[model samples]
Target: MAEARAELQKKETELTNAILKDVSDIVDAIGYEGGYAVILRSEVVLSAKKELDITGAVIRRLNESKGKPKEAPKVKPKEKPKDKK
Candidate 1:
């Protein structure tokens, strides 16, 4: 029974370590500035921030494209009609 108890404790510690690792990874990905606030306020804020950044990047690209003139698609010159068969 003592051996079984030791095994259980080991397993519990492993599980706790795994959870902490995941949380740390999440915190690191979210960054330090607003990450703590998001964790304290709402857990979904991290995902929201990620999505907002993606959307903002896409919008910025689209706006930049709109400001630039579209280039004509390049067409390679035909090979002189294949120089006769």
Candidate 2:
């Protein structure tokens, strides 16, 4: 059980890093345009000021970046054969 939990945590960290990297790219692009110096990770901070919070914007941008969800594959139904007339 401990090993399973550790593995799950490791995967979660990897996924979090990937998401943060993508969001950071968007933030960095905007920051560079606005002449901002640097952006810090929210998690590392002890607390955040309201203006510094960009969680909503990041989520919206992430959704837009990913586009619409993909359609699931269709499944064929089984058919029965007719008897000789």
Give the candidate number with the greatest lDDT. 2
Residue range 7-52, candidate 1, lDDT tens digits: 9999999999976675555454455544444333344455454443
**Which regions of candidate 2 are displaced past 4 Å?**
37-57, 70-85
Q: Count the backbone clashes (under 3 Å) in each candidate.
A: 0, 0
CA displacement after TM-score superposition, residue 65 of candidate 2 (Å): 1.5
In candidate 1, list every pair of residues with a backbone clash. Answer: none
- Model 2: worst 10 consecutive residues (lDDT sum): 30-39
lDDT of 2 by residue, 24-59 (tens): 888877678657686777778898688877667777
lDDT of 1 at 55: 33
Judge candidate 2 against the unseen true structure and give its global Cα lDDT, from 0 to 1.
0.82
Which residue pairs in model 2 clash with each other?
none
